[model samples]
Target: MPTSSPQPPPPADGLLSAARRNLREVAHGLTHASHPPTPLFADAPRPWQRLLPYGVVLALAATLIPVTINFLISEYGVPGGVAGALGVAQAAPLLMLAHRPLQAWWIVFPADIIGALVLLGYPVATYTVWPWTPPAIVGYLFLLLALGLRETRRTSIAVWLATGAAGVVLHVISPGRSNGSALLLPVLGAVVLVIAAAVRERGDAQRRLAEQETISEAERAQRTLLEERTRIARELHDVVAHHMSVITVQADSAPYRISGLSEEAVEEFGSIAASARESLAEMRRLLVVLRSDGTEGERAPQPGLDRLQQLVEATVRAGLPAELSLAADLGDVPQTVDLSAYRIVQEALANVVRHAPGARTRVSIASDGEHLTVVVANDRAERLGSPLEPTGTGHGLVGMRERVRLTGGTLDTGPLPDGGFRVAARLPLSPASPSSLEDL
Candidate 1:
């Protein structure tokens, strides 16, 4: 689970920061590299790109250091060949940092040491530069990046100061070079790099924070949607159930308003009307269960084997040609098994009506001292050329399957060989260790 936590971003100059923000976007795209965005870096960066920043800085330092050495050749009055070789040696470490940043840790220290040694050598060289513009800031800057990038600040700072002292030594050794102001250049470079590092870390933090905000917004939206759906379900269930119950009671009382009726005959007719009203109420409540609000948890009736006959009556009224059969001699089936059997039959028949209208339907419910079975078979659909379209989303079948499975049962649904569709489900008889507590 990749968690989204708030993060502060890195900070640098406008251009560097702008570049880095763009880079962070690229980095985020890279983060899901297991599923990369673009074709190339979606995996990982090419070797060179990973090394470019370190490479460029080191290359620039190496280039500058030699120029400084060439400018100072005369002041030291050392042999030209010896000075030239010393300059190349001084620049080489900086160049190496480009290809191998890890090596820069070792290289940065030595470069600082050499520059320090050269500063110390100034007394021996007997040299002087009146205006102190020591370009040796290059060594300090390299150390800054080393420490900043790698979090090796203490060692970097110590090396920087040491080499800085050596650079001062070089001037003091030269004749008439009594002044040592060139030492400050390395100190300034160290400060700049420290500031730069802080800026970088700050920007990274900010980008992470922005991502957190995005995720939080999405979650709030999801919560709101769920709440709204629950409210709607509650309202629909309450309103429909209340109204249908009222209508059912009213219909049952309707025969009393009939005037010229024989007392016994009227009583019989009223009795029949009341039965019809009760069945109608049950049908209306079933529709409410299926299509109205999903909230009001206990408002929906729990239909099970007790309600099987009602389900059959409802189907007969729906214009389906149906024959329902049940076998006796049933053992004690579990409550969950009994409930699941009824639901499977109910959904199977509903699907037949929706997908195979005007078809002959057969329903069977049986318990044979072992498993309880419920089977619904219907003729092929005239409209679809089959009871189910090949491209069905399968949710109805899936729901039926789930209900059966949850109750320790198995269900199968498919086209029957004889130009029809059949759904059969078998649920377990009473649990071996029957539950004493009512609710599971």
Candidate 2:
């Protein structure tokens, strides 16, 4: 094999090494970033709530450890400065942890463990001064209590057992054997252990109940969405079906009746056909909306006041020559009023086209102080042949009545004594009323 060329030396200033090191650091940061950050605790008055009580226990150890060490030294003549230093050192780690509540448990727990070992691990006879007994079982018992509040059951239990065992064993192993109150210390320490376990178990059950409530809330939201879809379907079936039926009847009769008419009359029928096509197109659009599953995004427009003109033109084209007269210059009418006016005019014209194809229609809109009136009156058809509007479901009239009432308006439709159909509506223009904002 041919000898391989020596690999190029690393960048002169160690650029390659620096780049590789930076890549490793970025990759390490990404890995850490993916983990949910430990949630920060809000700055509450009791930031050290969980650990301060534990600090009190450490303080007792500090006071007791040095005093017990000094007393032991004076009585038994065993001495050292180690007891005083270790007493203060015990609380140092705990106070540091108190500054960051979320990070305290890991650091404080281990410090408590090491502090206990440092004070108690020596032989009894070796350093019998304050190091031997002053801090006592009190410090360790309070540590278990704090652990119960801050940690889970299994972990707290382990720490509790270990600390309690150390307390009882060290009591028995010490050289000063008091034969008088043998069971006293063991019985009190055992009670502390039982209290810690109960507190830990209750915390676990409360957490489970909170999780169940969150799941129930999500299910209710999904059910409400399904019910809303069903309501939309029923509205489309009733509204579109009635409007389309009226347009079809007028369109079919126009061509036959006006055969001998002038060009203008023929053109009127063509316009009516176009209007019917537009109404059907609008109904199809409404059908698409009703069938859709509304997902989160921008909303679509509905047939409202803005579409009033289209409604009036369609009606006029339905073989009824109609004149539109505004009462108070209705221009910037509220959308709600626009929709109501459109439907009123639409239904009135459809009826005129069906009942009196030859009669000219006049639509008058006039505002009278606090109310507006809309009137559509047409002369009766010149002659009657086969029934043009059979199977009158009457739903068209009923729907118009409902829409008027919904808008706080009153409507009347009846045959004129002169043999024509006349429809009139009066709608309130109160400031609180939705249609009162109409510009016209």
Candidate 3:
């Protein structure tokens, strides 16, 4: 017996297999047509406008239902009851456009093909071809406009070009040309794109405006704080000037009041009085500038590293036991930088005196020609015999930060590991003045 070759599949089986494959392709397309992040149809300010799209989609589907039924019953000679059912089936996918737009497009392509093959008529007596029937135009135009709003510009443009190419191909192959309005589709798409662009630009402008308002508020607060600091400096100048004036007078008159005073003692008294008077004059000049409405003048000489020893001794006398260390030589630091450094040390020591009473404090200064680093640390407060807890304004750190910011410096302050507190700052050095090195 000869071996038999495998029999070819029958026509019915082959057709069924092809139909299943087409169904799978449609399902895959519909499932993969993603919903966009920013959807085109969304809630509108007017309640009716939000519902208008749904109403239009339903109306389009309804019109197509009657057209499908007439083609099935009158043209194809199907039973009236079955034709009604088939019409409902045909309208179902088009109605789905309101929810699954891309999926509905996928469904429409095959539905139109099947309708032409089965019904054997042209859009139920509409003059247009089965593919570009009135309902089909509505569906395609709506989908294109919606995609322009929902998807990104690149994706929308690609889809629009593809749709145009498909239309051109269909028009060339069809027996009759489509209606003349077919040429206006691109213009309609451009209009939709313009609307979407305007909406996006308006949203961006609003966001930028909100950010600018926040920045303006922050700058206003900073300006107010600096003004307050200047005012305090002006008021304190009077107290300092009075004490210096008293010291100058007392030192100048001391030699005459004492009998049998040595010549060296008299000379020392005169020198002490002169120095006090000079300091008093400088203080008065700086205060006048600070209080004046005038904009331009030379500022009084600011204290620098030369005054560090005096500041430390004064802090000690005020009952903050502070030790000072200079890790590197001060080499011609700028006057502003020098003044900022002195103020930082002064404020840190003051905080320790008020907040960390009886705490052993250490002050360290290091400079490497380009930058200066200052560190002040104090141990936790331990109640001593006589308590002198001065009330603080609580703006010491704020003032320190302002000073550091003015000098283009960075500051870090926090508690130490051993129940102590530390403040560290690094300031950029500026060009040294003529007397900067001499003062240091």
Candidate 4:
């Protein structure tokens, strides 16, 4: 055999390319307006609760705006119009922080720079904080908190770094000014970012866990469905395959058993035997497909309505008082419907016994020429047990529904007003035709 050619080595990214990619990511994070706004009073039930955040923001604005404006005008000798504009710019973004934190930061960061520049030009008080005033610091910190809560860690970190960088630039332009803000804002913002990011991560983890649980539940249901279908197929094979085998054997022995048969008759018997054999072979293939690994075929014959009385008596002995009200003349039910009816009643009784331990139950089977109706209903449990018991895998109903569906029937199940449960299934008595099966 010829040796395979060696695969080409993957190309590596250069330092310049890596740096460019990182820069592009940072720029995109800063510019993109895709982050969802954190919900205000997300778990609150009342309208007032929903408006609480807005009320807080309004209170802060009412206090900070006039104070900032007065400080800018009185302490720095800035023009009144300029002072009002700066105050509004710094304070208004705080209101926007709940819904639009990054955009608010964009506004407040530049305003702080300009405020610092203007303050640099005028006389400064000895006790005044430089670059970022008290109100400005408070508003920016709130904005940082919102950004950390809603935005990605990468984006939040970029904004945090950018804020520090702006503070540093203001410090550089105004030498001999207090640079405490340069250190203070970043440190305080870092702490806020860390806490908010932790909360965000926890929320995301919880959502992911819930989603995973939902997915697992769906998968389990689907698996249970397939398993139930396979079980039905296996039981049907046992019922049908037996008849086919018998037909084949009888057809093969017909020529010998009967005396003075014509050549045509002998040939006809052979053909019948051949057809039956072919059917048996097909059923065997289907059974093979339907069986799971290491599952042995059920050798015993499947139950029918004849066994319903026994099942109920057993349930009655099992602590549930169940009465069987089977019709006197149900006539001849189709084999599939017979098996399905038996299984439906069996499962319903099993449920009552498992869930409502001491409940009174009624199992009724009726046939009206065209259909066979099975109803298994139970009154409320007298025992100290919950109807929604956690003992079973909850696949009993699934199996019953599957059986009813296969028989081209309808099933209804629900809780009664008396805190009891009921299961009713209507199955066709006449054998289903190929066309009807296809329709089903």
Best by TM-score: 4
Model 1, runs deviating above 4 Å: 1-55, 58-62, 78-85, 95-102, 115-133, 149-178, 181-186, 239-440
- For each candidate in turn, the TM-score is 0.37, 0.39, 0.39, 0.87
The local distance difference test score of each candidate is 0.59, 0.53, 0.68, 0.83
lDDT score at residue 377, model 2, on the 0-100 scale? 86
Candidate 2, residues 340-399: lDDT per residue as tens digits? 666677666766666566577888787766666778888868656532342221234544
Clashing pairs in 3: none
As a whole number from 0 to 100, the lDDT of residue 79 in candidate 4 is: 92
Q: Summarize candidate 1's per-residue lDDT along 1-440 as a digit string, tens digits.
A: 99998786645487888977866664443222222122211223487666565567666766766775775575654456755655655555565443343354355445534544454454434344422324445544654564454333443444456546655665566435435545565567567657757865785597689889999989876665544433333333444455556665665565666667677766776676677567656755664555535544555554567777877787777666778887765667665566567767777777887788768889998887788888899987656443332221123565566556456567888898878999999877855233321211
lDDT-wise, the better of 1 and 3 is 3
lDDT score at residue 127, model 1, on the 0-100 scale: 46
Worst 10 residues of 4 by lDDT: 385-394
TM-score, candidate 3, is: 0.39
User: Over all chains combined, what TM-score does candidate 4 have?
Assistant: 0.87
Residue ranges of candidate 3 with Cα displaced over 4 Å:
1-126, 129-151, 175-177, 231-440
- Order the numbered candidates by lDDT, best leading: 4, 3, 1, 2
